[model samples]
Target chain A: MTEKTLIDARGSFCPGPLMELIAQLKSAEVGDEFEVLSSDKGSANDIPEWVEKAGHELVESREDKGVWHITVKKKR
Target chain B: MRILIIGGGMGGTILANNLARRLSSEIKAGKVNLTMLSASEKHFYQPGLLYLAVGQMMPDELYREQVSLLEPGIAFHVDPVTEFHLDENQVKTQSDRTYDYDVLVIATGSRVNMEEIPGLAENAEMFYTEEGALKMLKSLREFEGGRVVVCVGVPHKCPMAPLEITFMMHDFFKERGILDKVELYYTYPIGRIHSLENVAKWATPEFDQLGIKYETFFNMKEVDGDNKILRSEEGAEVNYDLLVTIPAHKGMEVVESQGLGKDGWVPIDRLRLNMEGRDNVFAIGDTTNLPISKAGSTAHFEAEALGENIASMVKIGQPVRDYDGKVFCFIEAGKDRATYASFDYLNPPDPKPPTRAVHWFKVAYNQLYWASARGLL
Candidate 1:
């Protein structure tokens, strides 16, 4: 099982959540899984799209308590 | 008394609004008349255009009707100025209308000199016009991943625009699965990414993370369109598949022809906003040769001070207000993050300093503009 990291992007807008995720991804090891939580509706959809395009893997995504939780795996 | 304003840009419109509110009260008492002359009918939210160029914003999001922006007390003229008869205290428009003024404000603004570099206007794309933005978008959409060069010509408006474009290009290619195939290069005449030290500190890391190559002290001299190359003043040649260039910016021709401007810009006293050697005449915004950033924030600040100064002159024949050369700018660094920078003659005298808080403030400020423009604030 890979180690898990959590990103709290609640209350942030588009590009904000994405930028935070990118910064975290830079320090994470390959194969590590990170979870991103965002309140911006656009990011709930945009993050997975960015992950897929950037050669990363999207593990899971869900909405709970009005906040979105998305999990991504570092592939490269 | 009659007052005339020569431009309808940020400084002109703000002054017009302030003056209208003040003069309207006086006009009812038969005290004064106000007139505003603008070359264009559309009012552009110029800062928003950078977002538009990056596909984050649409064209309709950046403009308003010119007439609607002006208050009712001021007469609006939609004509370009042909000549400034300064000695006679009159201005002749392209339509041949002559207007005399008890006081004159020259806010004619700057113009893009695309002809300075050979083949650049024809080959490279620009972001100064709506058409140019559309063209650049189309080019980006059809691009198949190659070297993209973003160059800043000397003394251009919005210094961070080239960096913003670079960030967006990085995001664009990354989104298209072509990040590996594309390379982005930023070239400028300055030593760093931005003139403010606070901004450059934050931006240098972002550029490194995005793998965007940058060259400082590189002056763009010419574009060899046929060979797909850009030559700098230092004899270095850079090859590119797509080129985005910000051409040289110059002052309005009317100021040049009337000998009121130096090197294509009107020289105004930084403290008073008054034209050099001329009393009761002022210049503001990008039109004046002020030692300040040519951003909208500076213009707005100048307009506020200028309005009060003019009002003082009207009320007591004394000009009391002073301009502080304060400038605040928001640099968008893609991925929904931006950095903010605020500088004046007193603090961080250098142009490129990095501050992360300023970037967040910029994001907040955009929301503030939306609220303010709609009069919600």
Candidate 2:
């Protein structure tokens, strides 16, 4: 089942948001997509980079209301 | 214009992000190339390590990859600097790559000199690094209670850490119901408990309340790990079951070997952030002989002026900004409260009381540091 999961890491620092997303991805099915909402500016770049490195598909990444909404799908 | 910054710690990373944002046009136009050379990709939030040692923070919360904090357009290199060719405006890395820059910023910070005092390398557990802190944490958890000595070895990074750890240890033991059994000794090489007058005054009264035996003018000249005793040069000896110390700090070997600082630190114009006799080179953070507290806050404050100074000089051929040497740091006074201290070369704020709100603010600053590193805050 292709489901979307939301992980709000708004107040976390660098690697916190990344670590959260990775943890969620571990329990998430391969077809499931994970969206991370982070206020840290580093997340704008970090999330995408991690997704690519981990062989996950980066669905979309956008900035809204000073928060970064990054979506990634597990590939394996 | 090629701007190369050495050391990817707080100061270098912040400056890189700042330049990339302020000079986006130039960078996009291929007119300015901002590159940062970091020894590794790991960027540790060192302040959080103190909390980690006492089980107040998780291990994962203390660091992130350096590339995670840097923005686009800044070239990040993971190479240790081996030599500085200041005369040629170039630096050589351990990878044997030579980079020549129109302007260079040295932010390599300081290095711990464990060899300074005999037996220090083997005897002491430190909170200065992740591994050291974790070892101390494990030791603290297993041991029931005994004499725990926290020593300020020399002028080291984060001057408040020794005091902060001592305070945290007090709280840790008290919570475990072993406070009465544990004898805490805090020592510094200086004649006083603190360097700043206001900080000393603020912390002096709490010494008795915490049941801490604070000693001054006690320098660690040698350590006897077998007996777990620290010997001072002035014929003073302190016996402890657990020994924690802040080791001696010195500038990077590359900087000293190049004779850039003859004084074992990068010599720079304190206000200008420019290297002495080298207009195209600038030094910031713990790397320079700024005679200021080498805390992340100092680097954060210096980054504002140093970044602008670099941007102006690259665009207009002269720097327009001056650094005021402002430094702000939170001193955690155990029992869940912390105090905020802000000062500069000219002005020092009055000592303020510790509060839970300031402690929360300190945690917020840790979170906010991520954005600040990206120059977003």
DockQ of each: 0.01, 0.01
Error of 2 at B11 (Å): 0.1
Residue B307 in candidate 1 has what lDDT?
A: 80
TM-score, prediction 2: 0.81
Query: Residue B361 of candidate 1: its Cα lDDT?
Result: 70
Q: Model 1, range B1-377, lDDT digits (tens) per residue?
A: 78899888877888878777766777667687888999889877777666666676789877788887777778898987788888898989989989999899998888787786778899998888788887888888889988999877655677668777788788878887898999898886545565444566678887898799988646667899989999975467899999988766777887877788654578878789999898878998888865456667777778878888887788888878688767766666764566556665555433244355655676566556643332233
- In candidate 2, position A46 carries an lDDT of 59
Model 2, range A1-76, lDDT digits (tens) per residue?
9999777666432114665565356446788998888776667775676566556799999999998999899887
Top TM-score model: 2
TM-score of chain B of each: 0.92, 0.96
Local lDDT at B125 for model 1: 85
Model 1 - which docking category?
Answer: incorrect
Model 2, residue B370: displacement in angstroms? 1.0
